[model samples]
Target: MSEVMGQQKNNLELNDNFEDHDSVSDSQVVDYLFAHPDFFVKHAHLFEELDIPHAHKGSVSLVELQSEQLRKKVRLLNYKLNQLISIARQNEQIYRVYADLNLRLLATQSMEEMQLVLEEVMQERLQLESVVIKPFIGAYAFPEIQRRLFVEKRFRRDKFFFGRLSEHERKLLFPQQEANSVALLLLGELGELGMLAVSSKDPSHFNPDMDTLLITQLQQFLSILLPKLMKY
Candidate 1:
């Protein structure tokens, strides 16, 4: 009976202390925990009982929540690393293709030879559906729509355009074949000399979202090379 009375007294004292400190802030508790690192070691069972609110799921143990966050971070890092590797591989492949095309262009002695080499590279190497290199001298002879496209200088700002082409545009560039998308590169001083058009059968093959580094490099190469070819 005496022991029971003593336990009841201790409980009453603890309750009174809690009531006195009813407005204890979270920061104060955190600071106390940080100061006494062995607090959890003395009450190790708290690891099993402590519940933390999760972002996606219901309340979980603190350890489980921390582990889940680490796993998510690792997964995100792996996905970003994979994307970087894919981009590097794609860049390497594009470099090889450009190198081969440059070597072929160097071997050409005449304008016809240069055109044939370009067509071969576009068809066989790049797997394009159609390729056309047209001079600006006869731009007025094309249909009214095409003549307007050239006369209006639509590509004067960027020197290039890429995406799905209209029916008339497709017909004007790829008359012998069908194309779902196209990349039009204005050659030689903003369409002053001509234009180079490359078409693909896939609708999304040449969208605006794609990186145009390869096409831009090719345009610069052609701009320098075409004038020399025409002179010969």
Candidate 2:
């Protein structure tokens, strides 16, 4: 009977000790989990059991949230891959078109024929608004004053110019056609031959930093061809 009484008293003392202490706070639970990095490895079942608040689904397990994130990343990667493929195809097509134009220019007989070919290929195939070759001399020469102004304003340093043109400049270069942006290529090695201007209706189509690979080839070919055509 005395042993039973002593055991009862010990149980009461244990209960009283527990009541004297405060309950564990949320911060204490978080601190304990942070202190033990391998806690998830030990309690792996919590990956599926723990509920995470979801804006769209009300609640989702941690495993479901991770899966959704992976799916979104995969979709974004696929979208970027598709964009790169589309740009590559476009570049290939542009290269082929420029190649065909270069071949056609070599076969051209007269200045008029050359201009016609440029207009047809550029306007019809390349979808440019206008293409013009303004010579410094010959029967189809551009006015000297306007030519000088253009050269001073646009070709002070660079052989190629690309950007929006002023209203007056647009009228001189592409009088009959609508032009928001233009790319200008100086024709001769010494810039004595003339200027070749290609215009687009879209304002952002041409810019200063565009690559001149195809256009540079075209300009070099024209510089050789124009002198021969002008003599005849």
What tens-digit string does per-residue lDDT give for candidate 1 at 4-110?
99999999999998897968888999999999999988998999999998777889998898798899999999999999999999889978998889877877887
For candidate 2, give the lDDT of residue 65: 92
Q: List the residue pairs that clash in candidate 2.
A: none
Number of the predicted model whose TM-score against the real structure is largest = 2
Q: TM-score, each model? A: 0.71, 0.83
Q: What's the CA RMSD of model 1 in angstroms?
A: 5.8
lDDT of 2 by residue, 1-232 (tens): 9999999999999999789657867898799989998998999988978999999999999889989999999999999999999999999999999999999999999999999999999999999999999998888888999988889999999888999889999989888998999999888988889999999999988998888899999999999999999983
Which window of 10 residues has the lowest lDDT sum in candidate 2? 20-29
Q: Rate the local accuracy (lDDT) of all candidates.
A: 0.81, 0.92
In model 1, the Cα lDDT at residue 130 comes to: 84
Alpha-carbon runs more than 4 Å astray in model 2: 1-43
What CA root-mean-square deviation does each model show from the true structure?
5.8, 5.3
